[model samples]
Target: MATTDDSFNGLTEYCDECELDTLHEVSVQIRTESTKKENAQFSREPYRVSECQRCGHRTSQRMNNA
Candidate 1:
């Protein structure tokens, strides 16, 4: 089961558009993966986002549950 604190590894939208208050299903992907090295590194995926179908506005923000 997924928990509130569970770090989901997929796309997540957490904000609404100011123009239309429409929710956008932003696309998110794992730009990079963790290595077995001492420290882990993270890379943000490109912002090749799409607009909300209902409002025609871009997503306000993108996030991961993790």
Candidate 2:
């Protein structure tokens, strides 16, 4: 269960420990990345991080800012 005061975002995901689709706490984070070429330009990318409420299993994905 999520409380209004604590729940800013929530995501539905499958948890291996739970073995079901459960609600997860969601948050956005910025990660720095650079190419492995000679001119390696650094860039910050936004990622969506979700943590399972039951098992605390965490996963991250690059956010589609489209």
Q: What is the lDDT of every predicted structure here?
A: 0.42, 0.74
- For model 2, how many clashes? 0
Provide the lowest-lDDT 10-residue window in model 2. 1-10
Candidate 1, which segments miss by more than 4 Å at Cα?
A: 1-18, 29-45, 48-50, 59-66
Which residue pairs show collisions in model 1? Answer: none
Q: Which parts of model 2 have CA positions greater than 4 angstroms off?
A: 1-9, 35-42, 64-66
Colliding residue pairs in candidate 2? none
For candidate 1, what is the total of clashing residue pairs? 0
| Positional deviation of residue 42's Cα in model 2 after best superposition, in angstroms | 4.2
Residue by residue across 1-66, what tens digits does model 2's lDDT show? 333333456756677778887878878898766766544445668898888988899888898655
For each candidate in turn, give its C-alpha RMSD to the true structure in angstroms. 10.1, 4.8
Instruction: Evaluate model 2: give its lDDT.
Output: 0.74
The prediction achieving the highest lDDT against the true structure is 2
